[model samples]
Target: MTLELNQLSDQVQALSATAAERLASLERQRPAAEARLRAIGLADDELQGKVRAALRYRWAGAIPAAEPVDAAFPCPPHPARANVLAADGSQVYPDRHGVALYYLINVGSIAFRHGSGEAPRVASRPAVFYEDADLYEEEGRQKPVEKIDAERDRRELGELARLAAANADAPAVALLDNGLLLYFSLQAQDRAEIKRELAPYLAHLSALRDSGAAVAGIVDRPRAAGVARLLHLHTLPMEALKDHADLFQQDADFRHLTDGALFADRLQPGERSALFENGSPANLDHFQPAGHSVFFFYLNPGPAGRHALLRVEVPEWVAHDPARLDLVHAALVEQCRATGGFPYVLMRAHELAVVTVAERRELEQMVVAALVRRGLSLSVSHKAQGKAWTGAGRRRYP
Candidate 1:
């Protein structure tokens, strides 16, 4: 076997022991941490100043609320008649050794109408990019995977806007499998180009806002240590604080606990944490200006002792409004209830978006067939052919 299980046993055993010890230690410290949470208050002016200093040095960690908030508010009952709309995307990256030098992106969406008990609407759209113009960046080099992924994210939002607009009469919630903040990939992209990229999508957010639809980005099993990082900052001495490096010094103190893991025991089933705005530079710089500063809260949608913590991200408008936030919260849990602790719409959307390996090969075959019809010769790399041949074999004793 490729993994050599016998050779890895000792390492796995050591990891298991380390994990058990950490869990016990974290449990032992829970009472003190919760006490700190209760005593926490937002020192807004002072906190903002620290954030600015960190930003000056290009720190990328989450900026937390001016004060600590770990409120475990119960979930509001879902509206008897509401619509849940969700969109997800999948892509086939450009392959140099394939039948054609092209890429494809497909988005799948669902508009699930609750209360009415009617059949849900579902659809998928696939786009293939083959032209030289579509394949190349502004600098004439092949477009990177980051650009393609960003476009996919944009298209997911675009589809949500279209769906939300179509169902404007009713209360609609648009859900994405990620955050609403501008993606980190844009840091590597040109500033002007990034702004251009954001314009249309931001306009869509505005449209949703005007229509009074709630938009949320749901992250399952989130690994973010935003709040944990904030708590670490609290332990730093003032002398070392200005450097922004102090945040990392105590990172190991909470390294084993994620925001979700820490909140899992505190939140009852169907409960959510108090809203906190993300302090990331991306949110502060681009999203906030457009009234879309990203805010998030952890939710336990699963049952007691089996809490499924989800980090739900919403724009500022949704965060400030109690009714809108309730709808988003209730609808998500309700959706999860029916799908075994995960949003059913998201699962269906992903299934519809995903491109299986067999389907990809068929697409390549179609491209090859079309080229042959046009009397054009195309060749795959010999290395790729060799890999395919070797990939199909199995070891045996004779």
Candidate 2:
């Protein structure tokens, strides 16, 4: 209890006031924003130029959205019978001071056949990296957490690909718990590193593209302001825009609004926004080259009054094909309806794939026991030993 409730009362009050004010502001600006979006309605030649200029000038705050977008979409009715396959991953990061120094990526997957009213098939697969080559970077350093995360993402896609292959006869939809695009940090790290990391993942995406499973990534409570950024760019004087720093430095109209908030009122239950491409370099360079450029749409999955904003990302092939896109849209809305907010398969996958603290500790003990039985003395850093002895709380009630 570092913070006392009594001490935080005034701050909490201030925060509530700010939140109410912002909510009111959002309500006020929503009309204008909708009109602005309607005005732009997929005409993005000028917006594309703005995006390119922002990239060339290294615009710090520039967000990438598809140049060609259909900013309006009506709700597609749920299909009678469709297979929903979702994959989620969890990881155990390498610990230098633990009994073993290795990382683990566990992928959990599920295939739910709606309309059949049957039980879903669920499974989990865990890959442990014990070898030096698996554990280390190209430069001989222990692989960082970001690299490990990307590996987990790759495994998630691989799991989707495997499931999609098995259920080819049925209309299948592949789901993920995150964005389809490779994270920006991985892209900025190194060209070779990004290429190496994304090669297999991109391949899986390409395979999934042709595999008949409509792959989509579902993001709950999304805060992506891509459309807001484009709207901001539209209001700017194109001729005077020289420095990218102006993007961040200027007083922008759509400062803190998210795509969700902007589209919430318009999208009723089960409805989705226009499909917009994400023009990040990672998408253009890696995924697009392989014919799987990532695109997205905002969806409202909750009831009429309580609109839950869910962002759905799909690859180029899925976006282009109406039948595939309908599968993704209807499948997601149905899944959300069953789960109340998010996809049921994704929730189950997380449960199956998660590495609990007890499991991790038990594995470490097994490692120590094996070493001891082999007559090899086990040694841990004194700092680690000291912390282990004192890490537990002295008073559970307190």
Candidate 3:
């Protein structure tokens, strides 16, 4: 009994010491966290006020109706044909410790002009544009394998900007598969690197806005707006949404359902969706250029779970001629077919649409075959639709 008492005493003492240390550390950090809040034009009292207001609002369960968009905008009989360019990037890496090591297997950009009836032109030369495997090492023991930090992202944006600038005088608009802002937060070193890298391109976007040239950042997901609605329903202040509480564990299940099971099947067993994290309000804030205010569109899913044509009318400053936009859409469809029926977002002067799962699988197979014919060894997994193909040592075309 005496020995047991002694052991208990020691454990109690140690726990007390640990608690004291934690309390002291928290006290020291409190002032700094508050100072950061203030520096960022926010304060504790202000935050509480917003949270209180959010709590007072009633929750609305129904999905909000989308506002009607004007599809037919008046155009001059001889509207100047604006060039449309679509760019996308793909990375491949070994699934093991090679996580951080990625082969930028492809960084392709396709450009097309209206009324040409020709296929969209490939911008990156086959040899010059593709980058070899680049090693990105992290600082600590628990480092990230995918080095999608701000610096690397910024470099990518810089390259895209240069491409756009080279063709600046071509009376064209640049289409990016992702958002304009390449980086999310500047709090971390990697994130800050991304910010620095994208700064030049953002400035160029500003110039385009001022020059009355149309440029847009197209995204396919609607969950972002859904999260925004959840925040509104919960009466959480917009500022608090920056912390992305709605994307936390409490709401993760609902958010997952929103994406539907189609894409979810593609994820590895333990892997989580990166969409919510990438499309968070905090990340979207970095897209602001002097004259450009980013606009988001929500495309509705059809009865067959396919995306019907949904139009996101561009602001007049970034609008392209309708005929030119149609040509670009046609090229995108062709590209989808070429890529093995891989579905892609179709960007038009008036709207954005989601590519169906059927189309996506078809595209993947087509692209894989093309790569095989070129003598490159390739393997593809298409389990999302309950289908997959494996190529053995021999590069046989499927």
TM-score per model over all chains: 0.91, 0.89, 0.43
Off by over 4 Å in 1: 1-3, 41-68, 184-189, 237-240
Total backbone clashes of candidate 3, pairs 3 or more residues apart or in separate chains: 20
Q: After best superposition, candidate 2 residue 66: deviation in angstroms?
A: 9.7
Best by lDDT: 1
Q: How do the residues 118-149 of candidate 2 rate in per-residue lDDT, one tens digit apiece? A: 89889999888989988887789997788888
Candidate 3 lDDT, 42-61, residue by residue in tens: 12354335443433332211
Clash pairs, candidate 1, are 42-66, 42-67, 63-279
Candidate structures ordered by lDDT, highest first: 1, 2, 3
Pick by TM-score: which candidate is best? 1
Worst 10 residues of 2 by lDDT: 60-69
Tens digits of per-residue lDDT for model 1, 111-185: 999877789899999999999977998788999887788889989998999999888767999999987875743
Clashes of each: 3, 1, 20
Which pairs of residues collide in model 2?
66-277
